[model samples]
Target: MLSIQNLHKTYGAQVLFDGASLQMTPGERLGLVGRNGHGKSTLFRLVLGEEDADSGIISLPRNYRIGHLAQHLHFTQPTVLEEACLGLPEGEEWDHYKAERILFGLGFVEEDMAKAPSTFSGGFQIRLNLAKVLVSNPNLLLLDEPTNYLDILSIRWITKFLRAWKNELIIISHDWEFMDSVTTHTAAIHRHKIIKLSGGTEKLYAQIAQDEEIHEKTRVNEEKKRKQVEVFISRFRAKASKASSVQSRVKQLEKMGEKEKLSRIANLDFAFHYAPIPAKRLMEVHNLSFHFDPHKPLIHNFNFTIHAGDRIAVIGKNGYGKSTLLNLMAGELNPLHGTVRSHPDLELGYFGQTNIDRLHKGQTVEQEIASANGALNRTAVRTLCGIMMFSGDNAEKKVGVLSGGERSRVLLGKILAAPANLLFLDEPTNHLDMQSIESLVEAIEDFEGAVVIVTHSEMILRAVATRLVLFQHGNAEVFNGGYDYFLEKVGWEEEGKQHR
Candidate 1:
């Protein structure tokens, strides 16, 4: 459907691509992979003609219709239904039906259809944007982080939808599982070029690992040969018997040194500092019920207790009281009808979207960590900052100038540094890349204290959660068989109805 050849793009001194080429055809779902700020979006812009490549050609069919999801939705329509129905064809009945079908599949109810789009949360508004794009039914789809704020149920629905989509697609996402389940081809941006591989995202990761292993072996062999040559040169360069051989060896060493190039690897050693597990139950909740409006209760008759060594995942659809429950537990929200009791020795570290606001704008990353825990020395704070991908000079940058994702990392770093036996995290993986998420999972697995996390990431949930807290119909249900059992018993079964 589209072709890119010799795509050269640069921003001043930084070169994003050099002769990168890729081709897309019908029935190919392409997953574009690259580090942040590495020109994946630049390639998209080149394809969309939003930015001119330094020098290259991006060829597209004449009058090809492309449906691209916007990073933000700008709604002028009065109602959510009206915004979703923006691009439908002439048939009024079928148009409305199709719009509603897409919206409902994405977790919007009939009641929500009549509400103003402005009233919906940012996540819900993004779903509306997705609905608009789907209703357009274009020839090619360009989705950038389409599952950014989606719940697990909505993510499953979108995955199933894209899995069955017949046309061409190119998606950029940090969700590896989502890409693996939906895409047929993997396109990786590496070494200033695009490497297209058969199969999915997992195959791309395997290929990268294999290539790194091969590169390591080659480097080792080359280094061994260079050392032997250097030793021979050093031992015989003074003697006339081996002078000519020594000169040749010197030239060979220079050539080897010039040709050597190390494989690029991301910094993935992120680890959360551990805390001592408390001897007592971390927290206890009894008959917890909360509601923003008196007429409709979001949480009703909820009771749960969190103990030391507990790794719990809170999950549900949007507006189903998952976040509210977390807030209630964290004491951010007062319960309408119950008590949240905590052990006197329980030290808590809470991480949520709003935690970013708690960070002092004047503070640097290292300073933030030190301020969080007075016991941590300068070296320890710097080490923690480096583990969070802020090393040396980057660690000295002020929090005010950092990106949203960077600020999120800073808050997480603070939470990790805090001497907290009980941790509360809501959507902690939302802003993290796959590598960072993997590191986070490892850290969570290694944590000795109690953790209560609200996330849609199956990887994190399966790896870190020993129990599942599910929100359903204004009540909470506890599942003791972990995340896999939750998927088997409740996750897939409930969302699969829309697919059928």
Candidate 2:
């Protein structure tokens, strides 16, 4: 168990947390939720003692063990398994056995155990980091965005593992379903304060909103009563002895009257405008096959046709060719065996998770969007940037100085401004806030183009996708309905029945 008391942290003039306090019990699974840049990660750092808070007291039992899985890490070990097994507690053969079992559960095979983690892809490295944290077997586990780079299957694995975990856990993640599956408590940071609720994450959020609504109603009724009492006293004060009782009642009302402070809810609405309608056939792929190596095929004989105003989602485990499929669709890579055809007038916009690495270091936000599309005027560019939450001086900041979320927003802004009839988005919502994701879903729903999105977010998929393309076991299957229908037909419950 751990407790934080009167915690305060500030960066320059910006206050992150003020008097935030929370208590955790053994085996408690807490889901930490907040908007981006609201110091969720900073709270984790404070608990881990990685950074000194401005003022606070973090208390835990003496000799209590802690494990933290950060967003990024560097491994120097010669093999992935070696790196994952480092720093595990000794003196218990069962602990070693558990470590190996965890590594295997995380998708490391016997052959992969001998290969260096440095040679693995970014997604693989992320899984390796998770394995490292799980092997430590600490009493409390702190996971920050643990599923950001993982695919659906790996996320399911983590969800199941955490559901069965017996120790305390504090997780910060954007995956709502995963949090609901694993956590029984919710801790939210908003406006420099922490709000704790007992329940699953979704239930907690709903309860908070319901409580706020009830508070607002109570406040309204109290104000009305106070006004009525005041009016009665004012109208009757000089009338006579008959109104003397009313005056006394007014004094009693004043004594009991207090205004409730209501928290302000920020409103964010995003809209996209489309040009004149186009033909129904947005893109058509025929017998498309791609291979990074000549002998190993990544996507084999892939064929799909996307029509205008269709929202299609691609789902798969990591390293199962989701990004590669997007690349082929975007014309960034050539198909090895077949042809990808698009409408003559179709303009394409591509958004990849790693697109930030391609940004020019010296380019400002203004320059990047301008360079992406030549005809945008200054005012139009600024308007586009504003929709993505970059305003005024932020538009002048260099791309190199922006945070990960900022960079992602800028890239998405550029994509939005382009005259694209077909959009290919690969993990586009990874670094985005929930508000931003909702805005994006709204934008996609309103856009008059075909969208092929590769993401693991069930919320987004269910909201925007009309069709599901599930990739598993080295093949793709086209399912005719939305994410919910796909889940029902695939029998996902059967896959987790044994574990449950």
Model 2 alpha-carbon drift over 4 Å, by segment:
70-78, 93-97, 207-268, 370-376, 487-500
Candidate 1 lDDT for residue 79: 93
Q: How close to the true structure is residue 345 of candidate 2, measured as C-alpha lDDT? A: 86
Please tell me which predicted candidate would have the highest TM-score against the true structure. 1
Question: Alpha carbon lDDT of residue 395, candidate 2?
Answer: 83
- C-alpha lDDT of candidate 2 relative to the true structure: 0.80
TM-score of each: 0.90, 0.85
State the TM-score for model 1: 0.90
Q: Write down the TM-score for model 2.
A: 0.85
Candidate 1 wrongly placed segments (more than 4 Å): 89-94, 223-257, 277-280, 490-500
Q: Give a tens-digit lDDT track for model 2, residues 1-500.
A: 79998899999998999999999988899999988989999998899989998998899999999988756769988987667768577665345456566766666666888898888888778788888888787899999988886777667677889998899999988776678779989888876888898886667677778977888899898888888877788777887874768868777896975866786654335554454445988788898888787666678887899988889999877676888888887778888888889888888888886577798879888888777768888888988777777779878999999888888888887787777777888888777766677778888888877789999877788788899777775666677899888777774432555368
Clashes of each: 0, 0
The local distance difference test score of each candidate is 0.83, 0.80
